[model samples]
Target: MSLELYYWDGLQGRGEFVRLALEEARADYVEVVRGKSSEGLGTAAMMALMKSRDEPYPPFAPPFLKDGDLVIAQTANILFYLSPRLNLAPSVESLRYVANGLQLTIADMVTEAHDTHHPLASGLNYEDQKDAAKLRAHDFIDHRIPKFMSYFERVLKQNPAGDTFMVGDALSYVDLSMFQLIDGLLYAFPRALKRFGEHYPRLAALHDAVLVRPNIAAYLESGRRIEHNEACVFRHYPELDKAAT
Candidate 1:
């Protein structure tokens, strides 16, 4: 059965992380809400499912994946469920748990990235919280980025497989999530990232390497790879971004 991913149409948002794994695995999946009304599976269909009582437990939001009778939500949870099934994690049972741990940390980094621009309230616009955002962004560039990058760089160096992949010796879903996280940071803080890259060479290499993978490279060129914009999690606001160095 084809996997059904319920996420907003034309917006990557948190859904891109799930999409990356699916695309990398070449899994047969449909972006449910990306469809049109003529097909009876569009954004409206996704919203309906969210409120529907058909399922014993409905997701609080989009980006949930429905596979046969099982449905999973939460980015890390969805990836954890899909990783083993899609062959995007290490075959070793223990290594899959390690991959999930890395993914959960990556999710924390992603939340910090989003919070930088909306430190006060998600309901308020960036402009409304510009002061708080500047403070948050500054701290993120100086503290959070270095902290996260250092940990991941250390993971790469310590990996028994080598510094190429996040877990074990292969391209796990964690690596894909790392690539997406770096891509967003670069877009959101190009100058800041350029200044900080020298401290994490292996991490940078992993990000670049993932971009060239056959499936991923094609996805980048395809319409599925939505460009980062103001509406997305990683938004670029010039004043809120700066180089720590």
Candidate 2:
């Protein structure tokens, strides 16, 4: 089975969630935008592909996966499609639904995370929207982060399978996504993250475990991992982050 993933060539952004799942499962796939020989056909090329009317199942955004004739979009949707096939989801229908629901919740939290830095406008420069960002960041750090963390902590605690994963005894795509969200928040807001870290030990441990997974470890060390920068969703302006506390 030939699989192709198209997204911005540099930063991980939302695409990294899908990438992490594929990597963790050792799935065979090609990162189209990161192809070395065709340097010019990078992120821009991927965007063009999304907009092309000639392509069937044209994706509305990046991070879409192509496997033969099937095309899937949206990070949660992509994971929902891949999870069962890759053994990254529970077998029972109810368990799978809960896992997908958890993934969707993570997607909402990610959107909120992105908005903390770009509250007013995603296209505008951080400097232009610093004040708005500060307000948003404060709300996220003080309320949203803790609220979401508590909810996830409850899910972990209540799971009949125990504290190992979001859904069942085995790891699921939701687990990887939770790890990504935690890592992003840590990178983008270390000070605020520290304040909330002790409140969610299970979530913290999950993040650590996912990082050490063989494929994830290699991905982090191979220079394929992009540094958090202003261009991406999670920007770290000192003032906004500071104001969060």
Candidate 3:
């Protein structure tokens, strides 16, 4: 059976991380919300599953995965489960855990990125929270970005296997997520990320490397990949973006 991915339509959001992994592995999966309603794979289908009382493990939000009868929620959780099956994880058990930790950290950074624009409240609009967002975005670009990017940069530089991949000597799901994270940050903060290569050379290299992978390159060029927009986690508001320096 094909794996079912339940995520919101019209935006990359958190789901793009999972999508990146699947695309890299050339995995056969169904994007539930992106499918046609006539095929029982659309927004209504995703809602039905979410609202189903008979479900033993109900998902709290979108970006969940359904494989057979098992349901996995959360971006990191979904990637953790799929990575092994997709051969996008290390063979060593301990290293797999380390990869999971890295993925969760990426998730944390993603949340921080989201909060920059929605610092006051997720329920509030950017226009309404413009004042607080500017402050939050300033801190994000000045402090958080460097802190997180530098850590990942160090991780790559310190990797015993090599500096090319995040875990082990080969590319894993974590690498894919990192690529998406950096790509989103670049899209959302062109000014802030202008000097990314100069500071975080390892991360910059990884991002460029992932962009050229056969499957990844094809997926990116295809219509399947959704463009980042204001509605997603990484929004580019000119007033909220600035150079870290």
TM-score of each: 0.96, 0.93, 0.98
Badly placed stretches (over 4 Å) of model 3 are: none
Q: Tell me the lDDT of model 3 at 242.
A: 97
Top candidate by lDDT: 3
Higher-scoring candidate on TM-score, 2 or 3: 3
Please write out the lDDT profile of model 3 over residues 197-229, one tens digit for every residue. 999999999999999999999999999998889
On a 0 to 100 scale, what is the lDDT of residue 35 in model 3? Answer: 95
Q: Tell how far residue 174 is off in model 1, in angstroms.
A: 0.3
TM-score of 3: 0.98
Q: Rank the models by TM-score, top first.
A: 3, 1, 2
Of 1 and 2, the candidate ranking higher by lDDT: 1
Ten contiguous residues minimizing lDDT sum, candidate 1: 190-199
List, residue by residue over 91-185, the lDDT tens digit for candidate 1.
99999889889998999999999999999999999889999999999999989999999999999999988889999988889999999999999
